[model samples]
Target chain A: MITSAAPALSRVHDVTEEVFAAIREVRDATVAALAPERPLVADLAALRPLLWSRLTTGPLAALIAGIGFIAAPGLLADAPWYLEWWQQHPSGQPRQLLRDLDPASSAFYDYTHWEWFTGPRVGRERTICGPYVDYLCTDEYSLTLSVPVTVGGAFAGAAAADVFVRNFEAAVAPALRELPKPAFLINAEGRVVASNSARWLSGSVYRGGLAVTPVPGLDLSLVQGPAAE
Target chain B: MVSSGARLAVFSPVDSTARVEAVVRRLADAIVLGLLTDGEQLPSEAELAARLGVSTVTLREALMALRQRGLVETRRGRGGGSFVRVPPDSGLEGRLRGLTVAELRDVSDHYAAIAGAAARLAAGRSLPSDLAPLRRSLDEMAGCPSPRLDGRFHIEVAAASQSARLTQEEIRLQADIGPLLWLSRDTPEGQDEMAKQHQAIVEAIERGDGDQARLVAERHVLDATDHLIELRLRLQD
Candidate 1:
């Protein structure tokens, strides 16, 4: 019986090698198809969809799915309140609104009278208030409150507002600070009005390249202020 | 005679298959260690079976076992037969995932030490060319608009050190720490602090200040470890 079965087993072994070879070819081709320029992380991302399919359709799929559910509890356990707030106010252009608000001074700005006005646009929440002492009120977006009021809330409302603003400022300040300040401005003439060190170092033409030349006889000084004249 | 043949067939013992499996394993090890060259044709089944003092069937079984190990391939047509094939190290991800937190911590320690050393070395060397890529990585990182890219920038920095072993180890470390980093990426405070730390490391590397680089890199990893611990505690609560 052993003799007879030995021959059959050998044949099975041969077949197994063939299948393995085919699998190897497939793997090589798949790896090669992922071009060298594609990063390892990108490769992982691409593999994830394939893996997901395998996990869903293969024998171990159920076990993996169960593990996924188990692992998800840690992720789903705590939803950050700030994230929720951000989502609710998606259009919350906090950076644009707080661009001029002094970080050190803004911490003390009063939020007691400040009301969080939900924007009509998705994901936007704006704080609204009437003008107060040391406050600059231009437009709704330009209403800069003093630092004292921000930290000077009477009760929990002030504390909550302070926390909310702090979170908002922290979220946006880094981005605004990193943005390259505009270097050169072309007035009416083709001459460069102003150039930042970055612009000078990089050598960028601000006014006229070949298309629309700078307007003739325009004042370059007018572009100096925060607002263009 | 017919009754006896039926009984023998029904109760046939295939225990010799274990011997075939053993041969397959040896061959696989040889292939993996580069003892066998890729595309090298293996001995014929008859030859192997004769060599092993087994029937051709058992030899075939051994070959099949090798195939399962990704060490060999077979062709069915004439002049087509078994050949050696090199398998990719696909087990890397699984191996990385299997690492315990303690193992990961060890890796983190090694990473910190090596990175600190590299920064110090680069600083002492003071070769502008050596520092160029580090600066470039930092610039790219600073320009990145998303937190995901920000995390990737650090990983890229580790990889750009030009040490394959270090890169591989760092990749494993990244996998171990990835989920936690992903969780923290959305937090404003977390993101800001992380970006600042990353910038500090880059600046130090650029300035050829090894001590600063070492301090920054070590602090970054330690801070991340602390954050993860804090997060775990929060979750426990």
Candidate 2:
């Protein structure tokens, strides 16, 4: 037992020493890699532009641009028309959306919209449609639709609105199904007649337009409202 | 392209010295930007000397300057060479304060959501192999009984999620939040609550209850946030 313990103790010491030495080696190597004589900076500088060019001018760029052009109308369709119109409007107040909508609700809507828009959709053919009855406000309504409206630019818009709505519903179905709350139905008037879970939305006044609640602790003022026309 | 006399002048020690300084500056910038990470061995001194077309002495001098900056450390032995130092945790307070309240809240919220998801996932999906290390971490936490250990416990869970980006972001955030957490750890209640939460999180993960795991992990982060907030408010008072 004594003889066994002696070797074990020595082995433990040896292991400890090895570990410390390894740590020292790692530290020294890290320090040397940081030496002033190293050519990493020049190499990285040369590499950066190559990466940037590849990202900006290569297939990746074209792919992104193609996707954007294809998806822009539908993606932008749900965006508040007043905001969209306002951007083109010579005398539009950018703050009108904020004024018309509750700041928190609008912000929440914007956040959720951003989340929903950026999220994956189920189909390429599904058109993007919005201005669906705003769950927040029953009296208010807005809609935007993006279809492959043009063979070139305007031709894709030839798809009927109902088709776009179907695609939008299809695209949004998975997320809606995953939602912990039951699907709430709103009529064209924008009233939430029934919902599965009503804790957050119940008793909250939803004007006919979509009402968005601000994320907790986020300041609504910093958020940009839809463009003013 | 230079005249013989001009070329001679350019090759003089003064010009050579200036060239060395420029090279050194470029190298320093690279290290700062993490083009070179800690523990990566440098090229041999002779190789570097030849590449730069400078005398070995000049290269040595540039290396020495870097050594003084605490960026590089040297070892002398048969197989020994220079290596980079682990950057010390510096400017931690300024970094924490640099975060906007909104940004901090967003990060906290994101951490909460993701950590919750990870806990739930770990509980529901963790294999027999996964439980051992997690159990080991719990054992270590129980043994160490330190706030630093507690922080490491949470960070380990984030790392266990197996997302490199998430792990890196968690480390950065942990570094930023280090001082505040350190200060909070001095309080008995803070220490006890943190430990309890950590144990609960581990248990939740063990049980394979995702919702419970998520809730526990989220509550743990929020508890830390609440403690930090209270500490800040107290200091102001």
Candidate 3:
């Protein structure tokens, strides 16, 4: 699989690397903001201007729908769970997303259990969380690329960015189309992120074990296969 | 225009095989729902095709179907393109009258399955804020039979379920036959009945009762199906 699909896999690798690089900037800034002292909840406010600025002017601006820091449980002095997330509105202004962190609330956003948080906490260098419908954020099918935020060798939280699958498809579909065979990008869970052929729809899990070339350094694979009938 | 949910369906990309039929159905449903109003000019074929991810040839086929159905008209030359022409009866009654009992039952059954499952999952998965959109839809339903709000209400439930596949299915179903299914909302009594049922489903979800939410959601769909069947019978009579 690697030998036959190396070029296509490289394209997928390049695009995924571009996305991770952007997310790492947020993660690096987060780690820096928390490094000097035992973190105060107010300290995260420094990330606000940075997030807003980057989301608006960054190279991945159009691809990323939201960007921010998601703190580890009890990492901040006053807040046990917090997400300093901001999503771009259709009007071009970005808005901060507020979710119930209270465990008692039925609407509580228990993001800690999500892959984006859990993967990094468990020591994965980077993670791609979903092709799931992000009802909580953009309400589009989204992929959350995240990196672990660490301070002094201790886990803190994750800095993540959201990319709507449609925009993602637009970005990489041309690349996938360049391949000689049907190809798709899948998260580690075998869920299809995007596909050049309609036979593999986004959000559908691909069960076939075909020629798979894993995108280096990310929990994603570029699989080449025949379209299912 | 349609609500956010239906708008997603309206502009969503379509695959090659289903391109013509999908485009026709989406535009037809939009017209029936009054999302596209009478005499309103549609975007050019090229633009519409691009947004829909289909070729201009396929879009022309869809436009021809809409013209045949009396839902759109095309004029050539300057200031000439396709324009919406909502049918006199708003196309709902006639379309309903056109259905056979079995077809109506099949579609209604399929909808109930989807709505029931979505409601059940939402009961377990939805955050408190997710209820806001559903509540707003109910509040809007109080005034009139706004199919847009009603369609949005169901789609929002699917969204609450946190499954994009379910959400997409709900949106497609709404665009396909939602106006017909929700035709009962046209009457004041029907409007109140629909709103109450929708509210019941929400309350069950709030209570975190998946079975109860599923029950209410399914019954709501089945009851609407019955009303549709009854109306269809009357049209036959």
Candidate 4:
């Protein structure tokens, strides 16, 4: 990392922070909604309108495709595990997403087994887990940011937000382009998230010599300047 | 039926030229696969064009082709917009017959490469939960035989590889030749065999056996190609 690129790298870092902040807001709301007691299915449904408004109107709105809560098994009074998720339609209306939850059914979406849910529950920390094709909420290449929702220190569920990779590229790539040397962003797994140059494709592993600059609080690093490809 | 994720993939921005044809095929595949329901209204032209990242002129041309194919109905006045009009059994045999044997083989080769590599990578990279959609597609095939069943299964497998590029390629190949290849799945025995093959692939992935997963996926595609080639020969005779 070069000393002069510090400002440019921070600009790129700010964009990521904005995304995490938006996801944290959703997580905070979800904790408040389930704090007193386990909410019935209807009570969970009631929180949709408020969450939808916040998602659509908040910062980085265009990049966000959806946001919701995924309950831990046996956390819901009526259902074993539940998803209070909502996805944005092209027509600008938000629709509640439904998936088969029966363990016997082949279509059952066992969210508890996914990285976004498990990372938070196991690590008890906010996590960012993607740049891979979502194939669930939005089929576009995406990143999911999640936080564990705890009730009195017991695991309850996770609150997560889906961000489109294309939009993230559009928003953050400009800052990356400002640097004198080629630069890219990589998540904890070393997969490229966004790059200023075409050499670093999203979802591909970065095996080049790494720069030492880390992006603020994220598990991401801003690799600036050149290294052996 | 096409998964909602696949439907969203179909609507993502077109990156290649021949935009008109690309748009036409995507919407046609959506309709035929039941991703777009019969009698459902489509978005306004501007909104749709924006979503697909295409110019209005290109969208109009594609819509014209769709209307000509009888896959869409354009009404005037109140609630006036294009609506999906799914044709009953859209000439599957005729479409299959249209392909030259050479063309069919070429497509099968390309599909096998993508599907095989996807299955292999998925076996190495995917979490156990990622196998749900593959099993779901197999269950759907066993319960009710349909052409879209196997195509969706392959797409789900590609998705599990966690590679967006491979997933996109799988979706494109499915749009191009999926219906023709899956035609044999309309038969009960064919459905059972197809389900078995898909199940083998799923089990291999669950067990994290990349070599086994790739072999099974490639063999399944080869067998389906042979079946389609035989059908083509019979039709020609």
Candidate 5:
């Protein structure tokens, strides 16, 4: 949204940049760690320390929930996972109970369909995929900001991180709210991601007037308005 | 004063149990965890019945079960009531030694989720006053990282998070595994290292750093689980 409040808008941009940078860092580190000679089938345990350390050690650590790889199929037989790492303690406490996930039971909705997985698979670009319900991971509304990890120009897998959606919205919504005119953060498909005014709801179509601008470092474009009659 | 967590966990309404069996397990857990101490007489039959939300008959049945297990000593006449007999260390150790690596990993993974969430919520929800208990726990643990106090250190963080349900769940988990977890930390190096990890989580909470607190808390638990798994493996060798 076009807010005169540059600082708040910049705040949104800063966090977006910071999160994407972490995803890029994971991709780069993963590529360097997995030698070309090694099997494309990744070792989750060996790769986890780097993900855990990179995600937890630095300034933006709090914003992330978990990070790891989601592989392309047939890479490892009997092991559907190329590598998967959920942050050690998810909500800020030690988990004393763990629900048994049947490794053999393919219960999850397909991961290949997810933009976080496929967008990078196709374009090989770092993609931010969410603010939606992550049925596969936290089972909460979250974001999966990811980048394609490659070995010798072959798509090995995608390195990704999970950020809860509430935190994502919090980081950007306040800035969007400071706008004077009717304004919205619309995704590529013209659906509202967030808005400064109540005339448009999040995920609803922004059926209003002109003045579209892109918020820096984010994929969503801002729409400023007067409803076109 | 009882910790906020203790208040929630200690006084639960246990109306939905299978009567005697649940009381027996509950009381046994309390005794082993030292929430009910040796030589400390339990409340009168009637008082205990009400407090436990069980009938006197059910409570008596549980007492009989505890006595049979050598966990309770019931004396008669004046100043007489059910009393706790400290759990046998041999039994505890034998049980510890019997555990497999897979079982210990399950415990660790579960602890990480509970403790990590508590630390995260504590950072956002805790007041300066809430921070006091965590500091108190750190000091108690620094001096002597006993099973009781070490477990309490983690529980206190959950309490500071101000989620009663989380605190209660934490208490149950801590009571179940907290004492046994000490088996691996009996060495001086393990104790000292645990203290450092505990300190990091505590300081992160004090500074209102939710991410740091969660990160440290999660790592601390995962580390403990790994140590236990390693020890179990070495014992097999």
Candidate 6:
């Protein structure tokens, strides 16, 4: 609601560029990974660990919670062909495992209706689904970044990566700890993903207020409260 | 810490035919905030009537009012009673967007107080395990496909405070104000800003910093209030 904050600040722009580039790496790697699979659109059940490993071997690892492809209808038996979620079962030794999604469950709550699915379908570009709970599937709050996975120029589905909300906040909190005033970041849906102040902190939504500045090149914005002066 | 049967403590039974609005408002708030889930059946008419301390006549009238607002629906025949039709403000944003800025500000102010106090108390009273849900809830908020879950974040924080009153008030506020805020639509930029703020609060509470928690909590609400005031000015302009 507060559009008062236009695109401003080079630092926000810098961070935005860095973040998007990392995402692009994820998308390109996914597309490339799919390209050599022979029947590229066939049940990609074997590629889960590869995709997870490829995406997490970078500076963005902590930010990632899961990665997978939600194949098109009749493509993967109505479920993601290969979904990889990070699991730390026996004390923080994180491991990647395939996410088992049942067809009956997937059918009940159509994926095509979800933001991560629809946003890419409509935009024909990579998109963000939510600061939302994938209530049935992931059950964790995440901002899923998804890009279309096409073979022979035909849309197969989406190659997506998730950033756990907790990871995002924990990573950024230290950097903002020194700021004298309240500042925060919000996703396109207006969900607050991170903040320096408690006012518009992570996990809350930012309605609107002063010092609103859009984080350039991303579907996000940065804002601070009014200046004391 | 989650006691399902605890809510009845907050509901005062209605005795007279005169307190219709009050009765309606209290019940309506419960529905909007998700103290009641979608399609969840209410207590039997007679049971509910007794519980609310109202005669069957007044209870019926309240149900009628709720039905008019699309918050509940009654079906005749077996296997049907008063089922929650709207299910915790399913249509919250749409309805809220139609409100004047003044009304929106008033609602936010009320929510802010409940939520801020809840955060402070949660910080004050809860153990580390109790505050753990903050992370989980924040994660849910990140990918929260709906506003109901987002609002539940505050309610959960209140619940962690271990104060029944704060928790109950939070449930009402989350239903009445939290989801409604999403109706107006915040920019992704604003959402990002808010997310960071949430993390700060969570960190403080985890550290058991009550004063800091209260300060942050109060600031969050005041800033939201300020936003509404600004929007109102723009409308007048």
Compared with the true structure, model 6 gives a TM-score of: 0.43
Q: How much is B184 displaced in model 4, in angstroms? A: 7.9
- After superposing candidate 3, which stretches have Cα over 4 Å from the reference? A1-4, A226-229, B1-237
- TM-score order of candidates, top first: 4, 3, 5, 6, 2, 1
lDDT per residue, candidate 5, B1-237, as tens digits?
323332333244543336687677657656655667779988899877755545687788888888898888988899887888886652444456778778888889888899899898777655544566568668766775667567656766876665555777777777667766765666888888888888888788878899999999899888777777776777632
Highest DockQ scorer = 4
- Candidate 1: list runs displaced more than 4 Å: A1-229, B1-108, B125-133, B143-148, B159-162
Counting clashing residue pairs in each candidate, in order, gives: 20, 45, 2, 0, 27, 46
Question: In candidate 3, what are the lDDT values of residues B74-120, reduced to their tens digit?
Answer: 99999999999987866777687667889989999999999999999
iRMSD (Å), candidate 6: 20.0
Docking class of 4: incorrect
Residue A107 miss distance in model 5 (angstroms): 4.6
| iRMSD of all candidate structures | 32.7, 26.2, 15.8, 12.9, 18.5, 20.0
Top model number, lDDT: 3
Distance (Å) between predicted and true CA of B199, model 6? Answer: 33
Better of 2 and 5 by TM-score: 5
What is candidate 3's lDDT per residue for A152-223, written digit by digit as tens? 899899989898888888888877877755688887867778887787767655666687878877788888
lDDT of 4 at A55: 49
Judge the docking of candidate 1 as incorrect, acceptable, medium or high: incorrect
Complex DockQ per candidate:
0.01, 0.01, 0.08, 0.12, 0.01, 0.01
Q: lDDT by residue for model 4 over A75-185, one digit each (tens)?
A: 878777578887776645565665445433222255665678888899557688787677655667898888888888888888888888888888887777776546888
Model 3 achieves a DockQ score of 0.08
> Candidate 5 docking category?
incorrect
What's the alpha carbon RMSD for model 2? 26.0
Error of 6 at B230 (Å): 53
By summed lDDT, the worst window of 10 consecutive residues in model 3 chain A runs over: A99-108
Error of 2 at B217 (Å): 0.3
Model 2 per-residue lDDT tens digits across residues A1-229: 1111223223223422332332233223323332333223222222222222222342222211101111222222222211111010111111001111222212212222321122212222322222232222111122222222222222211111111122223333443333334333332223222233443121111333323322122111011112221
Off by over 4 Å in 2: A1-229, B1-100, B146-148, B159-168, B234-237
